[model samples]
Target: MPSGGSTLNAENSGNHTLPSTLAGVDPLSQFLTGPRAQAAFTLRVTMDPPFAIDVQDQAALTVIAAIQGGAWIIAAGTDPQFLAAGQAATVRGPAPYVVADAPDRAATVVIGPGQSCRTPAGDHVDVTMSHGVRSWGNSPDGDTVLLIGTYQSSAAAGQLAVSALPPLAVFDTQETDPALLGLIEREMSRPAPGQESALDRALDLLLLHLVRASVDRADAAGPSWATGTRDPVVARALEVLHAEPASAWTVAELAKRAHVSRATMASRFQAAVGQPPMTYLAAWRLALAADRLASSTATTAAIAQDVGYSSAFAFSAAFSRAYGVSPTGYRRAAEVS
Candidate 1:
């Protein structure tokens, strides 16, 4: 935990009973439905030393905020973007990123990875961030303070729905759904009343709301490659691929899923999503297989089976074509990271 942040004694805090909507869900599963979120985080920092954190990353994605004291988030491999107070950010894209103070002292509250934040100088601090469907930060720092939240697929749904998030957006918290923010705070900070598990579920609800928010933002912004997202036809096709990448699929199958003619779907989706349907599916499958290979002890062939490849050699060939590196090499690089 950082200097001022500490565990809350939910038992001692005034026992705030849950609202009517949350009564039905287990604290953990509740938020997955887009309602009844329970976990939230709020912090206040006044610069002096910039903060950064690494996400444990079992969860799919996280959103960052500049609700008060401002800071810059430098994506692990991209340029730094400034966030003033009351702004929000979502980085559910490829590689992980970093955040810090330009002048050596900025503050931020992050959720997603259950790790700590670091300064630009490589200084790190332990931070406790919860992940589920929904997580939130309402730090009213008054400078570049950000309100961040996270959303991911269920444990059984591993990286299913969230990978389609559009990376580009107009970073502003005022444009978000007020109900989503308020609900996350209420559930996350709720008095335990003998229910810590309930808090986890509340966080899930907040995450679902975030996905909806992302969709709205995508609709408004139209399309851009930087967001790593697509228009409606492409997004729908993506949903199909994400839902069942392991199943045998083709351009025609994806077109049917999106309710467009195969040729129409092929051209439109490629134009909007930046990859042909088959290419995207193959790449997405290989990407997931690569992650499984890196994160687990699964052998190359077994990993292939899980992601629908017929053999390790076949999978490796496809993976190499997509990633320009062998699966083993990629795993080794990931290990080094």
Candidate 2:
């Protein structure tokens, strides 16, 4: 009953068209496509005043959009930011933060790892406070309403983009599209087959839009990887690297692809991207491999070959040097976490 003109329930979803794959050649699109959501955690929350939730879930990324009233996001050391109706904020995580009606309000609920909910006094509250399907809050008809989407497994691929953002990036009402927000809100509440996948794609689209908005801002403080996309030459080269991380790329080859000379490509790339092309490629490949290692059952050799490494041994050495852990150890740690 949202913008798409069909209920997301499975009974009607068969006739509902899935969104087209994001096929843009830009850096953000490429980054998102590689390690997009598989089964994201999304919820609608309603609350009243004098409420705060202490968040320590260590999720990779979270998008919090205000659907009704407003709330304050308080990350350590940074001043609290407010999200009024139709506004949104993205929180890059693994770090703990808090959300409340007022910046000074104490948290009454604590969200722990794996989204376990408890009180500050350590009594579990998830089941006790449940509202209904994919919804949770202190009050059923509270003045404030929020939609929260968390990306848990996309951390490795998202690091390049997230690193460029501050702990929180707030979007004012004018910057956010109301129709898109409504679509997400509607799809999230539907009890339909493939609903998880529907929400996953929707959340990915929202994140892509937010990254684009952040980069387009005149006062954006994002790193070279984000800001560099504005340059045609650097952007083309980035597209090449991200699109073909497994390709055996050289500076001359990259320059040729970007329609620039080798020397020109090298200088401009360094100035704009903050690293040599090969170095960036290596990091990208490793990031891809790391995510695969965590999320799939692929063998190290298979993953190595897939990401352009000559052999598992070579990949292991490079991965260890960069991540400070062997691939096996990294997988073990990921499983434990």
Residue 241, model 1: lDDT of: 54
TM-score, per-candidate, Cα-based: 0.50, 0.83
Off by over 4 Å in 1: 1-44, 47-62, 66-87, 91-208, 218-240, 253-261, 294-298, 320-337
Candidate 2 has what TM-score? 0.83
Q: Candidate 1 on 28-98: residue-level lDDT in tens?
A: 22224322212333332333334554343333355664534676666554456776665556665435555
Instruction: Let me know the TM-score candidate 1 reaches against the reference structure.
Output: 0.50
Off by over 4 Å in 2: 1-27, 252-264, 292-299, 328-337
lDDT of 2 by residue, 85-178 (tens): 9998989877888989999998899998778899999998888777777788888888999998887645455776655567788998778888
Q: What value does the lDDT take at residue 95 in candidate 2?
A: 88
For all candidates, the clash counts are 44, 0
* lDDT at residue 263 of model 1 (Cα atoms): 93
